[model samples]
Target: MTPTVISPASPVELLHYMITYQRYPTTLLICSSDDEFRAAIAEELKGQIPEEQLQQEPDEFGEVIIDHPLAALPIFRRVVARHLRVLFVPSVIHLRAILSVFSQADSPIPPPPEEDSENTKQGARPRPPSLFAYGFLELHRDSSEWSAQGLSSSASMFVAAARRSGFNPVMVEPKAAGGLANFEHVLREHAPILSGGARRDEGWQGRTVEVRRVFDRWFRFQTGQWDIKWPEDNAS
Candidate 1:
């Protein structure tokens, strides 16, 4: 199928195209920041998300600069990719996160504006020494070595890399939020296609596998094909 970029004057038009499109399979709406998207979606599609569920607070990294349209793109891509369909629209953050290699001690991307206060309170956190820094710092410290294949133990590293690139990742939740285990549960339920990691020496491929599964499950859950273990994952 052809991959053509669609541009419209507003987020409503974007969502309209996404909901109506038959060929694309999955649609992603991305913007530079989240507030802009949230405002647009609220204006255009008032009830897409409930008022109480939206995350009003910024993440420690200040990545909340992304809006709903842009945030939705990665989730949409993850879902569509799992269905073996080409992703529609492009989220700068999602694209950069998945495409870039991991490194430890990589410099931290500027925090989102909403997170400045948190940063001040936390003081200056040293940047990871490598591209896999997030992984090393959050998920797997010792095993933080960058592996271009498999689901490397450092999911945080991938998230951090995206943050470093000035992109906010819109996953169901932060691993610290107990989302990883929830994601694991979702993966087990769906019976997703998992590549053999150690055998193929494709740890990075495994990472993509996990990401795709999470997206697939999330989309399915949204469409009523599966039940979400926790509603919070779908809320914000």
Candidate 2:
């Protein structure tokens, strides 16, 4: 499947597309660093789809809330198998972790056996079936705090990662509710390809792994200066 990019005109239209095209037994992971955007998407989805179709609590709307992506690694397979409709992850950090897990699904590295454990005594536990087939959607909110270049670069990284992992990822940047019509118009133009009816040209070409490594190193190096300055601050 060819990777495609979607620029939804508004959040409402984006939610509509998500609810309309979401297939059964394949969960839709909506990830973003902005809590407000995440909640907004969830609220929009709840309003659009039937309440009974969703998984909610007695007093609150029930949705699978993942605090961290790495934490979900162990049960991701089970969650996908159950055919969850929507999952809310708080950050792109978690998204990266999930992508890494799926990309490495083919050759999972099992943990070392415990010393004299019952399971180890008999044999190592069998690895779970790969859960690489699932849909991913990223909704990037234009942050006033982040530069335009930063947002573009971040989006590019996501596009690259999705392409490398063979996922037809969809990304939308909805400026406001009033823009729904324009967003829907764009979606209609790309509906055929998004629905697997047509193949779009490849526009992303980058190694997500390498980009992540560079990002991590840069982050560490930038933050490491804090440790170096801590001593000076205390002395003064």
Candidate 3:
């Protein structure tokens, strides 16, 4: 399944998302490459999000579905372990998404699970939502949308993880603006999460960032509330 990706208006727009929606410390920044784009993004996010919170891409960039199952990948395992929301920022990175029934993608691999027959019965693992979760999946795309993250590749696993986290993600993008120019002057400004006046998209004209929740009504992971209303906002 394709990962739900978002190409925001600017880097400031992305920072605004983190400040407004992802106020908690449950988010994780997973860089896909150490190239200029990733480096620029990491550099820009310094004062806004802690350095430790970010996880740069490892050497195993394009070697997914190579040595181990997608479930066994370190990043995937970490997402399962920490219940952390993932922001898979990447540039020129691709991974093997699906393995055909006969194609030799991974050798000595076990047979894919077959559809159970009418009488065949097997034990199935229980799927339950996390008791304590406050995170969601978000991808801040640069100019080229779906170019970084594997759009039609291995992304279903991530969606499953988010569902277990007890909430859904609302992807924000540059609806009217042309596209993001670069990753500079990110986290330049921040508004209190609780405070709101004009909508964030109303007057953001330049380097200054006035971040707030992109949507007036959305699912809040921290409180498990969907209709989160700000007094100053939606008063009219």
lDDT for each residue of candidate 1 in 1-236, tens digit (9 for 90 to 100)? 11111111244443333344322212132423445445544554434556665676777876433345435545345324322122211243343454365332232333335444644775675322211111111121112222222233224444455455543323221122113344344333221133233323322333333333433321232211122246777786
Model 3 stretches with alpha carbons more than 4 Å out? 1-7, 28-150, 170-236
lDDT for residue 64 in candidate 2, whole number 0-100:
49
TM-score for candidate 3: 0.27
Q: State the C-alpha lDDT per candidate.
A: 0.33, 0.37, 0.30
RMSD for each of the candidates:
17.7, 20.1, 15.5
TM-score of 1: 0.22
Candidates in descending lDDT order: 2, 1, 3
Clashes of each: 32, 2, 0
Quote the RMSD, in angstroms, for model 1.
Answer: 17.7
Best by TM-score: 2
For model 2, residues 11-82, the per-residue Cα lDDT tens digits are 444444443444332234455433555556455555656556554543344444333322233423433333
What TM-score would candidate 2 get against the native?
0.35
For residues 39-134, write the lDDT of model 3, one tens digit per residue.
443334454554455344445564212221222324233333333344444432322121112122222322224422412556663222211111
Q: Sorted on TM-score, highest at the top, how do the candidates line up? A: 2, 3, 1
